[model samples]
Target: MTEKEWNGDFDPMADPEEQKTLLSVLDSLRSYRRLAHFNSTHVRRQAFYSLPSQHWTLLSQPPFSVLDSLSKLDDLIDSNAELAEAIFLEGFKAFMAPSLDSEWVASIVPEKYAHDEYQIYSIVMDHLNVQTTQGDMDKARSCVNQFYREWSAEGNMERGKCYEPIINALYTEFTARSQDILDLDKSDLKVLVPGAGLGRLVFDVCRAGYTVEGNEFSYHEIMASSLVLNHTDKAGQFNIAPFALGCSNHLSRADQFRTYSIPDVHPRSLLESEGTEEKVPPYERMSMATGDFCVIYSQPSYKGAFDVVATVFFIDTAPNIIRYVEAVRNCLKPNGLWINLGPLLWHHASRIQCSGDENEENNDDLKYHGHIDAGVGDPGSVELTDEEVVALVKHFGFEIERHEPGSVETGYISNRKSMLQNTYRASFWIARKK
Candidate 1:
């Protein structure tokens, strides 16, 4: 029989090389915290803070303190790296205890993401085992953050299926407003969905018997959308583990972590009618374009081609949203309607530093990732208020036909008990091109 080694081999007073590793891990975690600020995590944190205690109490175990851990780790890394590592390992073990439901996760996750799905589960289990010897809550948080960055599209697609309230709201609004104006029998109305992330909303629009074109900016989202659209049927479901690995204090309910199903969008699903045996025209009018929204519409053929321009959770993505308004105006024919539903959260309009000058909108070769050239003499730095945005739309020849100010319970890649939630008030409008 192999002799058992001493349970405590190292001297309590003597610090070792593990401290170096701990310092490295802490530094990486600090970088992640910085990155989290830039990503949608800031908004997600706001949503977490707004949750009621009852909801959190139902989903979490005691000693759930991500921010506290961060603060403590910061102090330790700055003073005594060895001590920080020890405490971090303890917290990591607590995070990875046997309570997680791995079997359930494997079962619901889409077969297409089998590798990432397995990798997600494997990483947690492997790290938990490592925590028995060495690990950190910060490290776990980093893992979760990485997972989210890679799998966010899948998670968002899941939420899009659950986006019934928004879908119903739009369906009702479109039918009531456009029924008299649009002749579906004579011609399929040309519809354009800008910033169509995963094409779920586009599918919804197509179901209403309109020819739809979805525009997406991100290459990753475009690929994810293609995977989902090609592999899944109209009503297929998949699963995603959105927040199982994060150890952030905002993650108030870690124990409630589990996989969630991505629901499917059926043809004419919003119509709310029973199925019929009679043959119907199949939904083939839907297609997606990968390019900058402002750049694509500037082309002569695309200008004044679409009958309806619908943007949901999209317009605010531009650095200068006025450019978005201009692009929409350029694309819609006279009397065409521009339907929009989203919060006025200008993603790129944050008062961050800009090259060239704030007043210069068309600084040629002034290329940021999604920089919108709002044309010459455009101010590109400042973010406009919701009222200001509407005014700009009106200035661009769009007359506000209907404007409804209300909130919607919406989120992307949110967990049942995680810290991040995307719920916010959305300004809905039906602006007709005059």
Candidate 2:
């Protein structure tokens, strides 16, 4: 494809529908551009440049066409920018891919997605000879770090967009179905939201009139969530730029960045009541904790401490799913309600070594620090289906009170452009300890 055709086809300005998704994809791929620039300049510099003297030649090349083979991708992009979404989608899938095992690339592709992606990105960079400006690199680094912090279930357009949807689901279960499912009312409830990313659900649960404590293992998430929980007073406004760019088919929103806001979680008691004199802040009893879920639950103080365990977007995070079942079984008081949500997407089930047990001996502690890793005994572990999970919980002395399996629309980063809605089936259930 000619440069003009490529430019026109990939431009995000012309199409309004395509602008949002494209810009979001571009925002996600910013770190990659920076990484490619870094790789070109520092590691394997010779591979990216024809010769040191030819650096000027590389600099003179068009930004998008820096690589000769780029035309092939450009042609594909020109043919259909929507189809070209995969170019950035697959390339950075690991960074922003949905955590659902059913939607996992390994289920579709025979090989590990990350392994293949690393090579594909490397080759693309070699062809592009991209040079990342120091300022741009710094911004890229910041963006990358933020994405890493919000990796699992934050920053993504759907997650941000679906925040209300998720809350709606929980609200339904907590209120409409409370008596039928958990055999309890929602008032004065003590909730423990394990694997609470960004503490959204935790705060929401509190707003729903429950005393909540969110337990998280990731330091980045804990810090990010704490900033909102502690720093921001009730009803206060706070903004965080989780992504750097929002490039689209046209460059219209290509440079458009997104800022995810901390939702206003007012203390329930703060609302003015008719003939009421006293008002209490809603989050007065809410708190956040940082520690391994299994370890924390296994602790003497935590065992049988919580009245409810809302493992939303969690449970599948364990290398051994049985451990989570056991942890929930241990921590929850007798007949305590366990409202489990989200798909049975095993975090360890992915083709990549994203997360694992850190308790393993001689396992590279550093490797599992930022990203989840399948510890020494991990890697190649099989994920259990929802049915299996239900049976396992039953074996662990819990009776399933409710089971509703359904699909939900979700996507990483933003989807302002494409009307494409990525959906995954999730197992929603409430199990009670016998």
Candidate 3:
């Protein structure tokens, strides 16, 4: 914990010293610790800095600065650092939304984040702004490549498995319009995406001609996504060396160091052209709201506020699954549709097996650490069986439209060439408010 401390000489915070002291004790929570270190482990590490310190004098020597100036070491230092700087310093963090600013991140623990057991909210904010650790570099690298999965065309296959169903479910309602009109007036429709990581699903839904709002609770995601959604000017406006820091599962260095361009689709050009009437783009239709899902959308005004609520790989984030069900039922209009696709990887109720090819057969081998959202479905969350989940939906006044278990198989931000690939045989369903 002491090693996570920054040098005392330079102040990363403007607040009093006592505000920075409790972060070490607060770092024990699994989710909090991940967000706290996301930015710190991401940039300007010893690996990148070591090159310049040792080679400052090399440029002054004969072949280095002259005709033979660029070396493999020079390439390593320049390329990796340049990319890291763009993503962390000059890019995303520069445009972070005020809602995701350091202070807000510390307080946003879904339902119980700021409760008695997790009181170091301000200290956690301080840690998010300044803490650093070296061992988490691999996690940082995976996060970097996540941009590829969400924003690049290369990720369409993986993203499509989860995203397409949700998008198509929303689109099905639009199909009833007259055949002559292509992309007819969908301005009346509203869509909500919770756990909208990096906002790709939000972006796609907005592009498809619906008024879309994405709700998010993670600062680590919103900080990085804001730059792309708001500031990027064109398709492929930014390039990342996504796999440069990963050292394992590569058949070759070429796989690790490959460059990937983000944002296969431009944000401003969401309104696709049809009859050449020069339609004014409806930029106002898209928005991202920040805060815990159960808290923010639970407002009186949000009741029956949306026509469709689309979730993909997100429902599992709930500390209590019933809160999620209630949130959906309350926010949706009568007969409004709820579309969900994700494995029941309950975030709060249980633990998982570490290594193996996870499958329906092996899934039963999973063990639990606490009370799961099962049997009787109590408040702290019990892991309910598939049929029990359907029962929960019916009890909450949702008529099951369809239940297709193990219908979707998709990888999450997978490294295709790696020795292993893990895919989910996800649960998918559509329910109408009765």
Candidate 4:
């Protein structure tokens, strides 16, 4: 057992007196190693420092300083252990505390963002984890549906509140860059926003006079974005030209209103009659579309077709980076542009797999360890190094245009203190097709 000693200035290899002090310090560190339960290898390392006169001069400083530093490190570990225990105890109390009054539910959520019906229902389901009755399930569903409706309405009302600043920043950056490559005033452009969460950026592009449509996979996200788009002042700014809004079910149904009569564009899918059967109306199909941009590479669509594609916080979430890049390539035309922003941190493999079997233990050993809401569905996550990411994009035949830090504030959000620990940092890049 080595116990570390704190000698103000004990040199390892010096006069006989200094050697004695260094030996004593090494002995103390050895003792502390045993007391602190450090591994046997650490104890051996400390014991090596105890040897007299041989490797004394090799040490960077007085051996006593190293010993003292080790002692302080031990103290830090102990303090961290205590803090973790306290946090665990507090979490247990919060989890097992007595049920609150049902009326207090409203107070639990902030008034501004309180209408998350599904979230509230999820909380209720979590509270009642045991097998539930049909009635209870139905009630939960109703509560969640109502919450969703209210949340949608609330988001519509506050569409431009906090989101506007971020969107405006993105728009300003993108518009300025676009002007450099294309004639913004003269060129007729079409824009597509994939994974268009909230669609705020889509609205911004539309307002800039480009024909734009948002493509989102999630029903909830699309609905939320639609609500915001419908209610925001910029709704009218959308390119209402007949060629902008493609032939789709929504547009066809909207055609009853004279104001909604748009120019006829090719339907994404066509219906065929089977052996003299009645002809069916064409149905809308979702596929990546492309259009010309003076500076087209920013958009991810068929090569040589689009001027630019804007992707924010998107690529890092794909489980298969290679496949994701391929998809981007398929969407962009030759000489098209791809613009991106957000953290470049690779997501954990579990998140990308969508296996739902991920637990805290599994996450502990991950390269990018972080906590998420317990019941949030498996989020597709991935993390890649800058070189790897660039390689993947290059493999798809795109050349890097510009890569730099984004201006957005990101990382763990805390009311007390912000922790900007970046295993992987954020980057903004504009790539162009060869």
Cα-based lDDT for every prediction: 0.51, 0.50, 0.60, 0.39
The global Cα lDDT (0 to 1) of model 2 is 0.50
TM-score of each: 0.54, 0.53, 0.65, 0.38
By TM-score rank, best first, the candidates go 3, 1, 2, 4
lDDT tens per residue, model 2, 255-365: 323333433343232322211321324544467665566656766777888878887667777767876787788888886778776776675554444335653322332
> How do the residues 1-434 of candidate 1 rate in per-residue lDDT, one tens digit apiece?
00110111222113333323233333333233343343333554456556797765443444655344334333322322222222233322222224457676566555776665323443443343222112333443334322232233445544453344445544654576567765433125677888776566666665555567788644334434454444344443433334533445343432333443444343344332422321233234667775667777866778898878888778777777767787888899887888877777765554444465762433422332233333212444567778888889898888998787664455544554555555666777778899
Over the stretch 1-434, how does candidate 4's per-residue lDDT look in tens digits? 00110111212243543223222222222122233335322564567577675564354256434444444444443432232222222222222223445566565545654665434433433443333223322222222222221223222332233234434544554577677866444124445565565454554454444445455432223323333333223222211111111112323212311121111111111111211232211111112211111112233434444455677666665554665565566666676677776665454454432335665434322211011321112244456776678877887799997766544454321111112232224566678777
Q: Lowest-scoring 10 consecutive residues by lDDT in candidate 4?
A: 1-10
Task: Name model 2 segments beyond 4 Å from true.
Answer: 1-187, 233-281, 350-362, 365-381, 412-416, 419-421
Ranking by lDDT, best first? Answer: 3, 1, 2, 4
Q: What lDDT does candidate 3 reach at residue 393?
A: 89
Clashes of 1: 1
Better of 1 and 3 by TM-score: 3
Highest lDDT scorer: 3
Residue ranges of candidate 3 with Cα displaced over 4 Å: 1-129, 132-142, 176-184, 270-280, 351-379
Q: In candidate 3, which residue pairs clash?
A: 372-381, 372-382, 372-383, 373-381, 373-382, 373-383, 373-384, 374-382, 374-383, 374-384
